[model samples]
Target: MDAFYASVEQRDNPDLRGKPIAVGGLGGRGVIAAASYEARKFGVRSAMPSRVALRKCPTLLFVKPTFEKYKAVSNEINAIFHRYTSIVEPLSLDEAFLDVTYSKYEMQSATLIAQEIKNDIRNELSLIASAGVSYNKFLAKIASDQDKPDGLFVIPPEEGPTFIKQLPIEDFFGVGKVTAEKMKANNIFVGEDLLAYSKIELQQMFGKTGSFLYGIARGIDHRKVKATRIRKSVGAEQTFSENINDEISINEKFTQVFEKWWERYENHKLKGRTVTLKIRNFEFETITRSITETEYITNKSDVRQKLTDLMRESIVAGVPIRLIGVSISGFEIEETDTEVQQLTFW
Candidate 1:
């Protein structure tokens, strides 16, 4: 699924076809959930401020998100995946990983299976999906995203090393802006550069993450694709219109945000043992404090009290705050038991 939400809007409403559009809020403080490829040409992207996106592409049209519709389509696509292999690991509503290593079709070729899936999506759902076929998840994931819209790329075992070597360190999964900068500072700019360091040396620089990086740099990823993809956490955050320093005002905003978070948690029927309070100051420095209860959070009042206590202990009354967030984790949401087979799709 490419430009999922926006594409759905385009598919449903012919007027939006070929036009630059976005999905999410159109309000001043709203953020984009997805953007059409046409909008992407103008540098608009998902997670961007809707205002900033409008500034980038003045003709951009913002449509409200239709989660129900998206989920329906997701279910349809998941069913299609099940036709080939039950080892489908859904990453989100639009994408998943499948292990076709022992597919029911016994196509015996991941590349062919990928093409068939893409064709089925386009023919049946009137949508495009890109795929990557490779021996391991890491290489497969990178390959899937390498091409656009309706691509199907393959990374055979023989070519993995050369391909991985040329990839920029920043492009490796899990390397954020800060880590990328650190890698560059240490002359580890690409996969080959990363390969220069011994495992011990890389570990010294990146701690536990270094070991994972070393394996990927060598074109080795052994992680299995689990059919049941359990969500570990869910939360929400807000960036204030202006820096807040007053205690009463901060708590007021916290209460408002917590209400929104609680509504979502209940909607998902998720409970967790830990509640985390995240705070960022005017200078952009951020910190988090968390409290884990012996029992899972059972009520809004309990979470609110924990949030109140965490904020009180963390915040200096007059310290201007740029952002505040609340989150809960350490609970595994139950997953429907789908069967197992593996093939890769982006």
Candidate 2:
């Protein structure tokens, strides 16, 4: 999926094809959720402020995001992936990692499977996808982004170390701007530069992340592709059209937001021990407060009481509140027995 949300909009509307478009809110405080390749050419990007994006690309077209449609498309893409391998780890709505080591179709080469998946997506969905096939997740993820708009790239095991050594430090996964700047300050500009430092030195400088950096620099990522991921937290929030200062108004709005979130929580049948309250003031200062119970808060009354207590402790009197949210977390993992068969190479 390339420019997923924006591409979906373009696919559904012919007028938007080949035109610079963005998917997001068209408001003062709105942000760009996704930018089309045409928009990207003008330096527009996802998470950019709508105002800034418009300023950069005056001809940019803004379309409201349709998440339901995107999810439906994602489902279709996932179905295609399962046809190739059972070990599929979804990174997001638009991207996933498929371990085709023992593909259901009996394919031995992951590159061939990748090509077939790309072809299936294009032939069936009328959309373009970029794929990266490599021996591990880190290299594969990096390779995937090397090409854009229906591109494919592969890094065999023999080439992995050399390829990583040449990559810029900033291009490495998990190296954000802050971390990149820190690495640059220490004269670590490329993956090869990282090899100069001992594991102890990196760990001292970056804590747990340092250990990860040390391994990836040498193309040694031992992480497995998990077929399932745990749902960490479920929460909802609302940004008000206008700021509310009075306690009565705040409480009313909070209740409304809480009820809506609770309905969603109930639908999922999720149980959690922690209740969190999130508040954003008129000045955009955000604060969160959480309370963890000894046992799971399964019923509405128990959860509501916890949220109410958090609001009382967190909210500031007379301060205008622009947003309110509630969430539950600290879920207890349920164990179940399931088995997946895979071919063992002799």
Best by TM-score: 1
Return the top candidate by lDDT: 2
lDDT (10s digit) by residue, model 1, range 88-122: 98877888889998888999899999999999989
Error of 2 at 204 (Å): 5.0
The 10-residue segment with the lowest total lDDT in model 1: 337-346
Give per-residue CA lDDT, model 2, range 1-346, as digits (tens).
Answer: 7999998899999999999999994787677889999999999999787788989999999999988999999999999999999999887889888889899999888889999999998899888899999988899999999998788999999999999999999999767888899999999999999999999999999887888889988998877888986666678888776789888888899889888888877776758788788898877788989888888887787678767888888878888887898887766763231212121110
| lDDT, candidates in the order shown | 0.84, 0.85
Q: Give the C-alpha miss distance for residue 210 in model 1, angstroms.
A: 1.4
- Provide the TM-score for each candidate, comma-separated: 0.84, 0.80
lDDT of 1: 0.84
Q: What RMSD does each model have against the real structure? A: 4.8, 5.9
TM-score of model number 1: 0.84
- Residue 11 shift from truth in candidate 2, angstroms: 1.3
